[model samples]
Target chain A: MAVCPDFSIPAPFFYVNTFYDILYQSEDAKRIFGEHANFFSLIDVESRRKFQRLAERRFEPQKFELLLNTVQSPAMLFDIHLKWNRDNHCSILCIEQSQRYQQITEVLTRFTQRLGMTNYDLLRRKEELERLLANLQQSNAQNDRLVELGRIAASIAHEIRNPLTSIRGLVQLLAPNLTSSAKLSYIDIIISEINRVNSIITEFLKTAKPAPPLKEAIPVTDLFAELELLCHSESLLQGIELVILPVDPSLMIYADRLQMKQVLLNMLHNAMEAISDLPNSRTGMIQFEAERFGRYVQIRIEDNGVGMDEQTRTHLFSPFFTTKNSGTGLGLSTCYHIVELHGGTIDVESTPGHGTVFRIYLPTVDKKPELS
Target chain B: MNATHNNRFFQASLDLTDSIRMKIIQFAHILLSGDERKSWEFIEQQLVNGIHSTEIFCTYIPLAMTYIGELWIENAISVVDEHIASCVCDYLIMRYQAQYITPPDQQNCQAVVACVDGDPHELGAKLAVLLLNRHGLQTHYLGVHCPLHHFLAFISKWRPSIVALSVTQSHHLKKVQDYLEALQGLPYQPEIIVGGRLIHHLSYTSSKGAPNKQRLFFMQNLHELAGWLEQDYLPIKPE
Candidate 1:
């Protein structure tokens, strides 16, 4: 240890005296200087500022710790006492300590302060761990659901593909002799049916595992036109009025065009079906509207139809949860999936007696984050 | 089992010897009669009581199948009787295969068990498929006379660890060689396992000196296959 020649002492004790802006402290005090070399310098910025303000008051003595340099030492403690001396025109700050404190009360006070800090740190870590655990559990549940979907899809695909393969093989045999347009249209129908089956398989796979969207800026007005054209015939047949109200002609969202169409068409079909299902829903109206709020474009498919009960509403977004007698239960689930893939959400507001409003929020093109 | 128990399922467990065999034979006959309600009760009971599935596949069904074939030889049952018995037994075997309990993380040494080109005997190959699958290997049983093209396609898609070929007649031994040649030319090589009635006559081995010689195996039964798999393929640790 480098000794301060003027203040060197043999006892393993510490003392500090302040006079004329010069600190005469014991070797043990010097050893415990946290960073600065002396008692006045050892005080942190906020504490020194507080001392400066308190120093202005008459008969006010500030009691603060001059933190020791604990970097190169073990078994440290600090005791700082400041008092204003009216006669001497100076402040006196004393640091009195030892290898161990003489008083049990002082030890207990330090122990209590450390315990409080440790407890707070422990609580913060526990909360963080619990949050992480909850996230992990949710992700695990999602994965298990996806695996189950894949298993079901695999079995269905196997059963369908055998007959499909046989039909396709027979069609190949018929293709060589076809020269007439009427026969050619039959071939076209077969090919289209095959493509539809393929599409169903693709949809199943999408639900089995979520994938990044093949995104582009798609205008809401254009999408509204597509939905109208597709559902117009069905609406007339089912005696449901399908209305398209385009609030923002220029509102665009970043999403897969085909996927967005499927989502809209699926929702519109469900709306029309819901309207038609009601015993007194002959004068049913299904309305489509698009509007922008903040960074998102909100597309609403509202139906004055048979709104769902609370139990159905709670399980509305879950895959394979359906209220309809013959529904496959993938209608809203797929819509929810596509919106999520585009970094958006699907929300519903409905009650049993009234009607249901399905609101889809897709972020505007400019607001969409850059996909990695 | 008590005589007053009324249930025929646990009757197999009543006796230590030939009684279990007799009980199984009676159930097999019951299944063939298409009385599913009566048959299922006994079958489900045996399965639920933790009877090993291999006991049914390896012992009970084979004995009943042989007995039915013997009845036909003695002119006791007609050809139609034999056909119905075989078909019913096959269906029941498949039903049991579907419900057989396997460990979730079971070892999967992928195997393709099928009849060679021009071989009509599928029952043996089907049993082998079930036996391998039940022992925790992913197995595909392609029924009778798997042509070279289909065989190649199955091999390419599954990339099985073993290609188990079965041929019942001696005349189909030459087809085995052609199948081996086709398999050997493929990019991914799966080991060929040849077996059936005429397996010994073909001298099926990895050697080529014999005329119908090919790299093939002759597992006398599922027991031998299980033994080989346990020695080499099974996972070192229980999962």
Candidate 2:
């Protein structure tokens, strides 16, 4: 009723005894194994152990991969399918599976190599991330400290300013009463010292709570002229070269002129101090430049002086962070606040042995605002 | 969102047409491939080229991360790839925060941004803080896994005008409710703004709006947050 499909053309099939002794071989098997009387002779030595393990399992039909010697080769891999008959004989079918296995192994090896490449990339990124995290943690800790200091300094400055004002007033009131020359000099010195302390407190308060800028459109050249006039004596005394690159007189910025000048003067003072830190052999130079870039006016101040290390640079703008023994460290922080108040940004780059450059970017004003 | 506000939200050097979508795809690839260096370079170039920080952090980064998440869900990317992308994103955010200089805290309206007590996802909260700070709010960011007691103590000490809480999943909502209940007992009640992925859940709010009677706002995204600030907070804030 049913037609039997010929399966001999696809694979070699044979019958074997329970001992794996070949009873009959198909034409395909004969061509493959070449007149082998027993299946044991066609099996490789390494495959004998695999065959033994396979025999220990249930005697139901199963498929396995084993190395079998062919007529023209010493050993070849094939898929061995075995089914047990009621007479204790086994019918076997053989199909090649080694080429597929080799292909899979090749794919796996390539995949492993790709994985290794990305693993290396991940490791590199991990190290970079660690460094970034450490730097961030340090910066955050410093910020916390500065915030606490600002809170304390605001109240302390208030208390100190009141007393300072009374002392100055009392001393000024007593100044005329001291007629003796020696006493007059002492009074003069006391007044000036009080004024200095008052100025320091003022700067400290500015860092704690900065006043909003009184915006006005001022010419860059005018600011540059005032700066040169203000710093002429100090640069001459320190014998440091102060170069102001020429700026177009038309270029202007809407900012608080007083606060802007204060920022420049403070930075120039720091540049002078940095220059003083180095030996007399090196010629200290400070270069200032202002230019219009896009919608912003960039102010650059560079100094050839004893530059800061990364540690100092990291906390350079913190309210109370200072590298100098006598420094209050409010100068740069106040400058930072002033620039930020003007909707501007400040950036600094310093190398330990080379120098330092500070760049301040402020929105440009094309035309001056009319005064009310 | 209004078209004008949406435009403002995505204000960047490149238009958010096909270009931004392309950028998102490129960014996702860079992140999933674990190319941290390239990711930074890409971000830096964008920042340098006049792309707003909010657009990059709030829009672009979030979009890229969402794509990465979707890929992981679809089995297109391995779990390891997702983790690597998350790590890279975290590092970039931290690095950006570290480098960012918040404008002087002249605003009297102080805000406290924190994740829920048990929630570990903080990128959204961090971005919120950065955006709020950029908009001139004095924001204190209490990062991931902030315990209830410690957060309460900080809230008491700081007495912020607004408390912005973030949660990543629906499971964290109960904890957020607990936070709201505890905050109600304080001497001064601060307006609360709840945000993050949990808010997008269908049950977080009803058609009638937020369940709480207190001054609470549920923001859907950074765009909504920005719009809210522009409408209510920025108008009142003194320069």
Candidate 3:
């Protein structure tokens, strides 16, 4: 007799109206059946109870045959055929079939494991795809902003050039006839306004132009040190403390030095403006800090001042949206567009009573060259 | 000579009796085995041996066993794991189904198969495509959870004779109804057939609250669906 200790039959095998006596039993049978020499008696109470319940009812024997064939057992299933055979005094037949059950279970277990691995792989791939999609979306939004800025710059240039030419002509005409003191004062105002218009045009041109590729790594700490010296001179004259916190050393970013400096200057100017209207009783303090974030470097400029409400903050980076009467709102908006063009993001956090904090994140160079 | 003749007659009778018994045993065994692959193979072999397709599928023994297996096994494997197995079996079934292909003299037919919005399960939809294609119907399969507008546009363009919508989740019934409403206003509206586990859950009520009133046919399984499509929907010529 062929006896399989472990379930190894690839398919279920069934016997109808036949019973065989066991000549030899494997260790697995001994372990599973345990002390019961007769295979029919080896069935556990639960199996016997199910068998009994099935026998009591006018059960369709075929219905339970599939379940029987798929489970490991040392049990006998009695149906109408067997009942008739017993009534006729014919010997009942029992066969060893647990190997088939074990085989089916093993296949099912392997199938489930394979399914689980596939799901995990798919989930991981989906997450990676979502992240890439988010990055693409952000890049698209930045492109839209750049296009808007380009239109604004073109219109501003067209509008201001004619007025500037007319003003220059009028100033020259008035210069020849005025008294010396009056002439000097008038000329000074005209010259200053002319310079202001020229500076606006220069800034507009810088924003509209495509950025040159970054050629060298610039250390952020060194840049901030130089900015501190400039802020210190102005702060001392204005009676405000420009606190410069030295960031962690070895922090570097890939960017053009001149462009980065321009961005920082704009941020500093905004910070200074925010703190200018602080109550006399409270000391105005502007803080500069930097830190490394995952795949990006972050820089923050914080100031204690009369902060803006939600409405002002929402349109803070919009062109020509400003709180100051004398200010051209392009300062911060230009800073926003410039930072975005360099593949960086800027965010502002503020409460009505608490001061504003401008946080900027710039992407880090990949450790290895990206495979195309 | 008489004894020899008697022995031969007795032997022939026994052989004939055993043959019939073997057939019954094999039928029960296939049902009892409940392995979908084996049962499908048996059915295909029978068909190849000149058994009528309808007769081979008339008995629900295999499908019933499949239902039982589904119920007994907890946490059954996902569709992706079964895709390979399904594809192999479906290929075989498709081959048999191809026998019913419309001859050159018959008119061409077109159909659309899709999964309703939020129902990402496309196994049923895939089966529908195979069956429809095998029957010589040009089937356009819009894979899964297509937006209603896209479905409407495709319908407007293709003007298929029938549209089969499969829904695995019951919650998608609302979206499917909305899609049907959108189709009602269109210039061309195809007959919509619904199937899957969710269709079984839909309660029968008066037409007053019945959504998607125009086109709704509930099918139990792929086999039943095939029969329904062939008997009810396919255009037949007068003999």
lDDT of each: 0.64, 0.75, 0.58
| Candidate 2 Cα outliers beyond 4 Å, as residue runs | A1-372, B1-16, B103-109, B202-214, B234-239
Report lDDT (Cα) of residue A97, candidate 1: 50
TM-score of chain B taken alone, every candidate: 0.72, 0.79, 0.59
Model 1, A51-133: lDDT tens digits are 34333435665554332334443222344444544443333334535433445435444643553344333544676798878
* Candidate 3 residue-wise lDDT, B1-239, digit = tens: 12233232233224335553355336534544435446555766776887655443322232332332232222232222333343333333443444445322213337778898766456567667766776667877787768778987887776777778887654466566565556567665466787775576665553334445555577756767778767777442323
iRMSD (Å), candidate 3: 14.6
DockQ of 3: 0.01
Considering TM-score, where higher is better, how would the candidates rank from best to worst? 2, 1, 3
By lDDT, the candidates rank as 2, 1, 3
Per-residue lDDT tens digits for candidate 2, residues A26-84, read 88888878887778888875456457656443568877666687877545668778877
Better of 1 and 3 by lDDT: 1
Error of 3 at A76 (Å): 39
TM-score of each: 0.33, 0.36, 0.29
Q: Score the docking of each candidate (DockQ).
A: 0.00, 0.01, 0.01
Summed over model 1, clashes come to 6
